[model samples]
Target chain A: MKKEKLNIKAALTLATTALLGCHNLAQAEPTEKDSWEFDAAFLFYSEVDRVSAGEAIFNAKKTFEDEDVLNLKLTIDALTGASANGAVAQPTVQTFTRPSGNGQYQVEPGETPLDDTFHDTRVQLNGQWTQPVSSNLTASSGVHISKEYDYLSLGLNGNLAVDFDRKNSTFLLGFSYFQDTFTPEGGIPNPLISMLIGDRNAPTWDDDFAKTRLGSEDDKTTADILLGFTQVINRRMLMQFNYSYSTVDGYLNDPFKIVSIVDINGVTQDNIYESRPDSRVKQSLYAQSMYHFDNVVLDVSYRYMWDDWEIESHTIDSRFRIPMGDSLGKESYLQPHFRFYQQSAADFYRPFLLEENALPTFVSADYRIGEMAAFTVGLKYGMLVNDGNELAFRLEYYHQTPTDAGFEEPGVLNDVELYPTIDAVIVQVTYSF
Target chain B: MKTKFKLTLLVPLIVSATGCASLGVEPWERDLLAKDEMSLNASPVDSALDDHIYFSKEASSGGKSFGGGGCGCN
Candidate 1:
């Protein structure tokens, strides 16, 4: 009898042990590879260059900026494969033109004033690997290589994430280092001489202005750090916040560009080549919130950004996805988006130059500076194609105008409209396997 | 300027308020939401492309994304 009782107790103990082991196995965390997914896409943009409302104001110049742009991408994810998990390859091609003739030359009678058009192509590759050390901690590292018409960049990034509880909150810390090489096509030249000649063949042009090579090569390094948090306030709302800081040092000039000077009589001409400031620091804070109420989703986000170059910007963005009731025997949805943005101009942003002025180290004639306000309205439609496929289309229009600060002289430099309204259309199709 | 500011604030508030009122749906009725079309960012690639174009042409950046290199476009 004693032996039988002992045997029964042992059997019960073994069964309990087996059950506990199974439970632990079931609750074990998934490997990094197991949670991975791969995605790739191709995108194209064809700008309608010839929309007319009247006698074209500026006889639109046909430059590289007028060409259609295309981008191709391939991303590979190893969910359960090996030490490496994520990789991406992206290539893009663009055609842009360099303006010729005096900056104000009119189209030669019926000559179709298009000048030089050059194709710029870029390719980039990135890869990342992740490892989990504990139930609540994970670490990841990544590397990237990018090459463009006049520049090459190599970068390394690392991140660590911690989950406080499996439930509703998480924290992420990350850092990135970037090293970039800028190599101009014809080498760097004296800014003033290059502008005065307007042609690359001038004998005064010097390739030595470039810090690195005969191609006018310059190198820059940047370091960035980021911290982010996501918290679920309740069952229906989620909020996230992120803060980032970045510092850049070394050569930071645009070698191919020249500064323009405007005389007292309002006549503009290209002058000495310009070099940009060698260092910049930027910081940003962002917050986003989403609420799920029944069938509707509401998303709102805000961002504040500041840079050491005396540029500060504020942005507010929001979107509402609404499912429309059956109006034409089909179910559809409409999503309207709105955004507001304002920024202080860069320290070196100038609409026109003073003849006898001391030139800054860096300057840009680009008009996006000067305070500006923009508004956007958009709509989207989705049509079910099959059980697992759908087609979606989106249309959005935006209009912007300069703000008070942008109009220093009210009627002088600001006479020409700085902001041009834009219209865009987006269409996509998706299939799930 | 005042008009623009009011318009900016009013439009979003009205939309959100109206949207909030009609937010709830039965679980089964959420079939539409379950469909990928209802996602706020259904097409990430297109969004990325649009963001790039706008970043290159306009004066703003950063909304609903992270971790892309900076350019001197602005």
Candidate 2:
């Protein structure tokens, strides 16, 4: 009787364990790979006759049985080719000193000035730790360091996520801070200082002027905070919204950028280093939705951003994923992506300064800060291989079109190409296991 | 200098987002939602690289995640 009772107890325990295990397995989707996982990708970006870049990124993650996770990432970027120097086109051949002040480059008549020495390699490293603070709360923190030929940046961030309403909703709060330093070649240019043109060769070059033109290195700091909410509207749809606020202070000028000092006829007279406000605040609101269908998934997002510089922007992006026939049963799909962006010019944006007008306290000629509309069209395909591993490739095209300066173009300047459209192509390949 | 934060502005936002748990189904009904691509950030690396490219080319950045690895590109 004793032996029979023991057998019965063992049988009941076995049945209970089997029942729970079977149900859990049926309800659980595979979200984590065994032990460790890696993701790596290579990107190629090229702009028509302007700039080109090659970049690679590698990411590794380890998951513990307890649900704690660790992640590390490395990024390497190699950039080469010419970049716009924020100078308007001229009817006559133009020559200007390079950022180094030790050299010069020439632009042909009716052509925009581009600095040909634009080149740099950057490397960044990042690490993050995530763990559950409670059944419904998770915390994550990370640190990143990046270095370039003439720049360095260090940053730290932390985030907290709380699940409510029986895990149907999640609220997240995050903050990050960064400190960056600049060590541009030949030192930082003094704001509003007139640049000496080919001083070593110019007949009227003055040594005294060079002494007052530059300063030592400079730095800047930025702080950002974000609040986010994510909710599952139904089994087939999910939505997320976020609000972000950021502040930046310290030296804000691009040491290499200069503004053209032009005369009444919009003819080049001299060049002066540009200046910008030492502080700025920016805010943005973002919303996204993802919906799944029987054979396809659709994702769409939008963002509205504004800043102290009086710059406002709007962005709309969408992606549609359609699965291929019998391609690992929905594991393989083709995705089409589209994005459109538009921005208003900043308060300090200037295509060129009028020699007769009094100088402003803050000014910049960078076209990036001017009114512009941009769009991107892309296609991506992904397939499953080696059982659960994945391989994907994408190709995209981007175009930027700038609006009229609205300032009257004087003399021959009206015939010059003031705002040239930028066209670029991007290709990428990624692998994950 | 404007648009300062106020609790009054958030009161309605929070109220509208909460008390909607009834919209969800039982735990067993989450099979479809559990798919890997269903996550908000299904592909982190893809997002990161795209952010870097746009940040360098555009005047406005950051409607997504943040942690500056900034460069003097402009």
Candidate 3:
């Protein structure tokens, strides 16, 4: 009787073990093969009579069996052409100091003053790794380094995301830091110094102006944080909202930019090195929504941004994609995009300083900090091939308009267009497998 | 700036709160949202390119991603 009872107990234990094993098998996820995705694109951007840039980029991503991911990206930017110099146009020829603050260049009458020494090539490399910590959590980290002729940036970023509410909602936290160094072709210039073409009171060209060698290098550091939330509104819709804050300290000024000092008669008195506040804090709130239907999809986003320099901006971007051939047994789609952006001028922005008044501690003529608006319209075509490979081509047009910031020009300068409209075209292509 | 921040905060709250009315979705119903085209950033490479272009041309930059990686163009 004792042996029979023991045998029965062992059988019951075996049955329970089998049932548990089956449950584990049912919960196991299907294994997938490691996959690779690649993307390559080239872009050409031009402004009417200002800077133009051509850039090429390549990216590759590898996904592992455990759902971890690795990404690599490389970029090459080639920039050339002339850039606007803060000096206004005059009835006669105007001579200005070169970007190097060493030599001089001449701009003819009825012409927009520009500096032709704007040429440089930049290369950047980035890598990222993402790992799943649990079924509902993920962590990712990335590092990047970029180099130009006179600038270098090294940065690191990390992110963590957690999902809740049965995977219907997710929360993300991210942080990034960067250290950048700048060493211009010539030494850094002292702020607010006279850069006259041929002033008898100034030092000779060969003497290497005393005010032009303040330092050989300057550095800046940036830190940022982002808090984001994403929720699935329904079976075909989802939305994401994020708020980010960033701070930058040290050497915020552009080494090559300058502001002109004009006399009452519109005569160029001097060109001084541009100066800006050494520290800046910026914040932005962004929201995006994506909706899907049987044959089409829509994406929309908006951003509201503000900075310590009293610069505020608004952005709206939208895209619509329609599957043209999905119902006909073909894999192709068309997408149209629209984007609008507007920004307020910085408090310290100045087109040019008046020689009659005392110089302010900080001033800059960079057009980017001025009141402006831009719009872009674009279209794209995408096709999916066998083996999950894809190709896409896109084209876009951009237009920019600048508003007046209460500038008081003298003489013929009053008639000159202080802010000229800029028109540009962009073409892009991408391939991924 | 603080007022702007408060306004920004309120808009998303109202949006998300209204979204809560239809928040719940079964796992099987996610087939449509699973498509690559439905992703918030469908083409990351293109997005990065556009971001760089805008950052170089505009004064204010950070919105979708962290602000780092300084450039000399600005």
Candidate 4:
């Protein structure tokens, strides 16, 4: 009887162990089912004297078997601003007389200031869709449409990505196409005028000059391609590199601006409309790396860029995020940042033009001339607002200086050095759930 | 401009691919990368505002992203 009782107890223990194992297996959570999620945001921004801009954004995403399957994004933006109109004192012709045998004309110059203002607005819409073909393959496509004043643009872009080595290595190919058209605010019928009076009795104005209005209609097309790589060196380090090239073709000039004409006697005459290169090619190489330590994060980046228009630039950016407090509490940090930037001038950049010299095929009096430098400092603070929420804020200031190449005339109009130094303040806020 | 665009696309692809190949992080290591602040553009609104200011005051353009409305200031 004792043996049988012991055998019965052993059998019961085995059965109980088996039953518990099955129960635990049955209680395990089922593999997560495929799911979809949606998110949306609205942003509004305004500049003191410029315009107010707003955007509405919507995003939808879905995942299957723990992998992203599809994503759709849309954005609509609107910008409205008052016309930037200002008046400048200019000389007006009163009359002209020729002196006997002097071969020179005497003229009267009257000063006048004209006042003008404008109203401008624009709207743009963009849509993007992405789909995963396999565990390691994905494709994305996008389209955009915009309208401003008399200008319109339509664009399309697409990209394909393939992953390798368990999603650590990825290869991507992309293409983009853009078509744009522009029409000036005023109808074309304006007349062109010369500074010097050649034939007083003949018609010196033509329709072509009138048709080339400020902000006139223009057509343009652009295409681009890119390649990139990213790597996680260690638990505390990461890095990435990228290369890109692009081409742009079409009317690429400011029709509103005029080139000054000077007489042999060093006197200014009427201004003539100017034109620029119709096409441009640009390329860039960029690399970035980050290192995270126990108490701080160090970031650095470099970019080399060049263009067929004789413009080249090198940019080096670095930042360090250091934790300052939280000795008594968790999740408290403060970071201060600094940035510096510099760039070379464009080929067509010129401070002033001489009357006796032959003008180049393309020329510009715009003052983004020579070399430039900028410095920025900022601070960020982060802390938990509550059990389920966090809050962060950032504030920054920036300043810049002109290069030695500077402007043609130090104190004169179009002189690069005379341009006022830039000063700006930026603030950001973020709340998360 | 065209070459710049191409370079932008090429660089991103090459970097992403190389990163994938060299990455050895376990699934749990992605906690930081999955954070919203890890994105290149932390605030789209602020970025857009900065771009607008730069476009109005400078000669260079097309750094933030693609597709923007036309402005007479240019």
DockQ per candidate, 2 decimals: 0.08, 0.46, 0.59, 0.15
Residue B12 in candidate 1 has what lDDT? Answer: 85
Candidate 2 per-residue lDDT, tens place, A145-189, comes to 999999999999999999977687899999999899999887888
Angstrom error of the Cα, residue A45, model 4: value is 7.5
Off by over 4 Å in 2: A1-34, A201-209, A327-330, B1-22, B67-69
Candidate with more favorable, higher DockQ: 1 or 4 = 4
- Model 4: lDDT equals 0.53
TM-score of candidate 1's A chain against the true A chain: 0.67
**Considering every candidate listed, which one attains the maximal lDDT?**
2
lDDT of 1 by residue, A223-282 (tens): 888888766554466677889887879775554444446555433433444455778787
lDDT of 3 at A394: 88
Give the Cα lDDT of each candidate.
0.51, 0.83, 0.82, 0.53
Clash count, candidate 4: 50
> Which scores higher on lDDT, 3 or 4?
3
Residue-level lDDT tens digits of model 3 in A9-36: 3453345336435333332332343544
Candidate structures ordered by lDDT, highest first: 2, 3, 4, 1
Error of 4 at A160 (Å): 1.8
**Which has the higher lDDT value, candidate number 2 or candidate number 4?**
2
Docking class of 4: incorrect
Q: Where does model 3 exceed 4 Å of error? A: A1-33, A199-203, A326-330, A385-387, B1-21
Model 3's number of clashes is 0
